[model samples]
Target: MKQQQVKLISLVMVAVFAISLVLAACAVPATAPSAPAGGEAASTDVAAPEAAAPAADSNFKPVWYAPAPHPYFEEVRKGVEAFEAETGIKVEKQIGPDWNQDSQNQRMEALAAQGFNAFSVYPADAVGTNGLYEQLTPNGIHIINFGTSTAQPTTASFAVATDVKAAAMRAAEELIAAMGGKGNIINVLEVLEDPNTALRKQGIDEVVAKYPDVTIIQEVADIKSVEEAVQKVGDALSANIDKVDGIIATGYTPSVAIAQVLSEYKEKGGDRTIHAVGIDTDEMVMQAIKDGVMDGTIVQNPYGHGYLSMLLLQYLSEGYTPKADAYFVDAGFAFATQENLETYNNDILAVTEQIKSELLDKYLEK
Candidate 1:
């Protein structure tokens, strides 16, 4: 009986020892030095663990590719140019003939063969683009999506673009406000092939549904080009000219198309006061805002999309790695009305700077 008692006490002692060790281990983290060594001042602010600074990779060749030429892409090209000037890293820039998945695949493969190690691409097709990334990544090629992202489970390292759904929702809110909270809207969208269009469509529809007074009179999709966007938007407006009180376009092509059609409508003495909100500050779209032809456009940081993607690619090539949190980097956007048309660009630039400052902690692990 005495041996059994001793054994029970020994087991309790072992349990207590184990618990004490765990407590001690936990307490070590909680106990921090109150003062720095050698009488140095201690920091009051706790900063995130700093990632190692990336080494410059002069030999890495990166490409900034677009599926087609548009004003939005032109702005993105300016950012690419800025990156080239800033980094002294020459980018092999290429523009595809059209926004087609097969074209993107062929062009990217050709570039890859020519020794481009990094690419900042606007996926020609959101779902289909992943196949290209899947092929490239295993071969040591790093791909970044500039304007839009592929569908989830992407092989691309990062996507530098505006939050399309947020931008679209904002556009809806702006449109509804411009129409005095009640209107029949003509919703113009770009290609249905890109999944961003669906997110954008959902964003717009969700926002409009909140206000019972707002109704989408006509919604058009699958506008593949500026020509198609213009013709289709014009037709939609004509068909609902008497009933349409507002037009909202969340895609670049459709936005520019809306600006042109509305400007013509205003010039042709169309008596209907159609308030329009569109995406991207194409020179024509901005001019429309300035000329009072359209209400406003959403100015996304296309420059940031190009510049940051290249910057990230540079880091990636230099052996810097992305944190798990670093998936979609929101370049940001602003409503470019006549009020801020000239200076709105400054706001977009600020967003880029803010993201850059946070990239080490918020994005890249190393």
Candidate 2:
């Protein structure tokens, strides 16, 4: 009986030990590792960190293009940079080797192939650029004209540029005023290929017609470079130095050339008071104004051009469409004379801010 009791106690001990082993096996962690497919063991190493969230506006790829390098483009680039900084969207900025539609077409096509879906372009040739746009827009690319507009009936969504005719008329009026409303004028034009040239010429001509005494004695155009402008303007001035009373340059290259040539003319003691008005405020142009060599300049908002075009592209990418009849967005311009030279930029900035405030209501639709 004693031997039987000992054996029974030992069996009870064994049973308790077996139960403890079962409980220990059951007490797994609350979070068991999920088995991979095919009954594979879960990875023991820590999982890699999740990929970083995509950048804001990353879905929209934008390209800012200039036909060629110019001071105006540099200023516009500042606005593009500002947009990038504000929205955290990178712009693929490009400058072509030359201001030709062929160059633009080739480069733009390559960019499109690389997945750029939006473009802010300075139309190299106003009419020719529309052809390229026709090809691009069909493929779901959005285009905004930044510095100048393509010819009418275009595929571009919007033109964020100055009213070229109005600005030119204003420039002419200013020149006429400086000339005391009646004088012989030398009209200097830039590339004839540019569509803006025709409008500017018309503006100047209409304004001149209003004052019968102010005759355009000589018209010099086809100025592709500042050097050419200097040569031609110098020749025209030399020929009419005694009779010519006012000069007007309605293009960027000629405007700069006029400033430079007039400054030199004054420095060389050319006593004639050649009243001059030009468009675009290059540093030399502004200095000429300060020095009283140039009468004034029409300052277009290049910064606005850069910022507003990109903003429009961004909105278009985000499901907003341009409002009806909102194809031409006048970015506005200012006449910068010596009186307001120091503060004219403030006026231009005011214009930009106003336009920005109206983008949603005036320019775009959901």
Q: Which candidate leads in TM-score?
A: 2
Which segments of candidate 1 are over 4 A away from where they belong?
1-55
User: How would you encode candidate 2's per-residue C-alpha lDDT over 117-229 as one tens digit per residue?
Assistant: 99999999889999999999999899999988988999999999999999999999999999998989999999887778899999999999999889999999999878998
Q: Cα lDDT for residue 214, model 2?
A: 92
Ten consecutive residues with minimal summed lDDT in candidate 2? 36-45
Please report the TM-score between candidate 1 and the true structure. Answer: 0.80
Q: How many backbone collisions does model 2 have?
A: 0
lDDT of 1 at 42: 14
TM-score of 2: 0.81
